[model samples]
Target: MPNRTAVHSELYSPDSADNPSLNGGRCRSCGYVFFPPQRYGCESCGAPPEKLEAVQLGGRGTLHSYATVHLHMGRDIEAPFTIGLIVLDDGPAISSTLANRTDEGLAIGDRMKSVLVTASTDQAGNEMVELRFAKAEGSK
Candidate 1:
């Protein structure tokens, strides 16, 4: 069995899988949503600093843009990997790997859903997690 504590520490620390889904900072006073989780005053309507709150976002989205990477920093991340910008159904867009498929038949405007996946092993031999998108069940 995997060491749960080590796995959690490696995969769930800071910003990888702890929150799994993307989040935004919402202005409590004006309901403005800021992607990348703002820590200061609101960008919309200039709300005061005290009104910001972390909001969990739904990970369902559509493919906005994509690219098939054949090469990466010395790691050779497997050829024909599809990386895409997913525009969340209710919030901002994020860049993530499109899971369970190669780039051969992928196209823009494809619908996808976010999923947490084991990315790889770290230098310490612990598992790492990352967010990825995949075709929704029954999607063409």
Candidate 2:
């Protein structure tokens, strides 16, 4: 068994065999996966919304692209952070605000893994958990 502290938050969906990903949607018609869940329909095939289903996404992927944020959005949002798209092995590109990781010395196509991070705090003094990507430990 894995030894770790469990965080209580809604950053992702409950871990279930049916829907493992907290924020992933898959099109039953076209097999296209989406991050942030497809509530309307398939973006690629324009299928009926009913054809979309929720899914649990794997934690590993390759860095498809990225950009550095120079401007600040809010005090909760840190500047000089990197944001990027990761191509998951399950066939979806997930956008994440990279945290505790650097864009330096890395390139597109490098292996990366998803991580849960405490991005900020809520008004109630609660930690806001977020999913971010970092270079896979074994990757260059």
| Best TM-score among the predictions, by candidate number | 2
The weakest ten consecutive residues by lDDT in model 2 span 1-10
Candidate 2 — what's its lDDT? 0.71
**lDDT for each candidate structure:** 0.67, 0.71
Error of 2 at 21 (Å): 4.5
Candidate 2 Cα RMSD (Å)? 5.1
lDDT of 1 by residue, 1-140 (tens): 33222233321232433325566668888887666675679887888888898777776778888888766665635665888888887767778777854676667888888666666766676555556688766557
Worst 10 residues of 1 by lDDT: 3-12
TM-score to native of every candidate shown: 0.71, 0.75
- Residue ranges of candidate 1 with Cα displaced over 4 Å: 1-20, 74-79, 122-126
lDDT value, residue 46 of candidate 1? 85
Q: What alpha-carbon RMSD in Å does predicted model 1 have with respect to the real structure?
A: 4.3
Displacement of the residue 94 alpha carbon in candidate 1, Å = 1.2
